[model samples]
Target: MTPATIPSRFGLACVLGSALLLSACAEKQVILPGERESVRPEADLSESRIRLDGNTARAIQLPAQRVNAEWTQGIGSPAFRVDHAALGGQLQHLWEVPIGNPDSRRARITASPVVGGGLVYTLDSGAQVSAVTPEGAVAWSTNLTPASERAIDSTGGGLAYANGTVYISSGFGLLSALDARTGELRWRQKLEANGSGMPLVRDGVVYVVAGDHTGWAVDAGNGRVLWQIMGAPSVTTVLGSGAPATSSDLVVFGFGSGDLVAAFRQGGMRHWAEAVAGNRLGRAVSRISDVTGAPVIAGDRIFAGSHSGRLAAFDLHGGEELWLARQGALGPVWPAGDSVFAVTDLNQLARFDASNGSPIWAADLPGFVNDKPRKRGETWAHYGPILAGGRIITASNDGLLRFFSPESGQLVGQVEVPGGATTEPVVANRTLYVVSSDGKLHAYR
Candidate 1:
């Protein structure tokens, strides 16, 4: 195909031996559940031209009136996506307080803080959990460590709040329930080790995905195991994963192998399974197929992204593939009324129509590129992007809190935080909260 015939979205062209791109397709390119190994890429998108497609651009229609009463979990409740949220006062820093530990060469913060019941909860190094008031006053604190103090791995495994209790999944393979207000330990059960993903609670059940990609459902009140499902880990994958998105009687999650599956919430029955990976065998860095981004379940549609380069939408009701975009995504996809906002791996902020995989707008952002030379085994860092109050809120590694207009993807506001935020900035009850890698929790009005 010639570049003139391709959609302007990115100047897509696949002229046989000339160039190729997944987004350059003329129509729906259906990738099935079993096509993971068959679809070989002769050329990757490393050389594809990426520019705003004037023909496909549409005015962004993000919901400006949607307000969230509380951010109870890592990705705003269960479905891992929320609509427009209300933010009051100027986008200025109100207060900052230390949480637990600082990010180091050996340890780092990867999970986001959650808020509920007039109190905000956070996890820190050494498996410590703390609760603070909306005014930044310390309410209570407790450590999830055992009597023998072995250095905790990913201590901030996952955090969730429900029914007046705070649920925590730890790196040492322990799931504990605590009093939301007092931080008193109610009960704890040893599950499996290296439970790095966040936990979510719904319908009297607490859900968690381990570092190995095994999903488990435990009793909300007593911590009894209800059901478990295991998935094989990928040979190469990303560092962290997202919480399982749940809606009604359905629960969906993407694995390290680029496989997305929908199962029943009550019995753990498999409803459908589909692979979301594309051929990235061209380079060593492009070989990952990790769906590190949380899947968004809105209404009857499911939106997910992968590191290998695929942004796909699916029909939730029938488990059928809807559409796919070749832009690689690594953060959570924000779904508002009719628009979806995401941070593409190519360092671009993009908006797409939720009904189909059509481009609305794209903006450039300095992505996770470290100019400094690494000595040996160095960990990766990212400036998490989120949608708040109809604005694209980002806390980059540069320690800047920037706000951009959703309509045009233009910079609107910027403020410097004490420490850079590696996790997504969270919003609740008309207030924005950002957790810094230095263990400080900053609240903005």
Candidate 2:
């Protein structure tokens, strides 16, 4: 990607403010074979129409398969089949694991656990990285020292499991490649300190964001630093967020404060760097959680939101600007099928046209009316939204997790996750894993 010298102000506002910073502000175990299965999938499993309300937990029935919808202004009638009603309240509890200290919310498990191949990997507030089985058994755990004191932000970019190896980044600037089955360290490399963004593994390359406001592509096999360049940081949390999106051979990411960029995965090279905003708030908050939105890699385009409330679609191959939309709050974009769900700072969820940057449907989540959301300085839809089992699961700053119809953007069902859900909901094996700020791990199926 070729770096653009003349940064577009409109693009900056849309990408950085809306897509990266604003939206960016912002998981659990499996069950055992026996031993009182914590949660089970809903039982009244039958074809039903979805009821969009708080009291009712219904599901929508559509086609068995859903195709991407063409770009439209409003959420049209479902062209596919949905089973939203299957997402009922007959939730069962699954296994629960405590990965952090009860007193220090700082070392919390803000990073959503990545469940794959029967194992879940997560980072705790103590800067401890752990791998566990579905039954709450810790396979291995490692303590990491952050480069700085505030490194353990509200979240920690998590580990990437691939090809029998686990890749993780510590806040103290260490990236390690470990054996996935044993969690044994294979290789380690040092980057800037306090760097803790999740790594994206494509082919054999691992890409991660550094707290120093740079992006690096490392060799997953040997932990060699392939390339490092200054790019968007993607979010404002202490552990940092945002997973770089890849299109063909290009890797796309946003800087902590400046712009969205695209680089080549094979060679530590630049494809395009488009500056989307200026550092108006200085480096404090910027370093805390700058560009927090992930670059959602769609077909031929790259979709990304920013902390500044700006959203942009860039050409994946050329890194050229395609379109930009402004939504005045920071949040991240969650894509369901073809539609991208963008959340605002105040806890509002907006659906946008995935192909082209345009508004489709929107709804304001309740909790913000009391002004406590702002007074507490919590961004709505702060954590990334989850699109699974025909439902969009998202939580607000005031601590409510709700499921919505992916096609209609209507609020379907909500449950109070007592301590406030600051982490993204993890859906695996038909169960919902939720981590609350109150030091509780919840499961719903």
Which has the greatest lDDT? 1
- In candidate 2, which residue ranges exceed 4 Å CA deviation? 1-90, 102-109, 146-155, 232-239, 278-289, 328-332, 366-381, 439-441
Cα RMSD (angstroms) for every candidate in the order listed: 15.4, 21.2
Mind giving the per-residue lDDT tens digits that candidate 1 earns over 310-387? 788888866788998877677768776577778776566778778887777877666435535454233234455677
Lowest lDDT block of 10, candidate 1: 371-380
> Model 1, residue 204: displacement in angstroms?
0.6
Please estimate how well model 2 matches the true structure, expressed as its whole-model Cα lDDT: 0.59
Error of 2 at 161 (Å): 1.1
Model 1 Cα shift for residue 130 (angstroms): 0.7
How many collisions per candidate? 3, 68
**Which runs in model 1 stand beyond 4 Å of their true positions?**
1-57, 64-67, 76-82, 281-283, 368-384
Task: Name the top TM-score candidate.
Answer: 1
Query: RMSD in Å for candidate 1, one decimal?
Result: 15.4
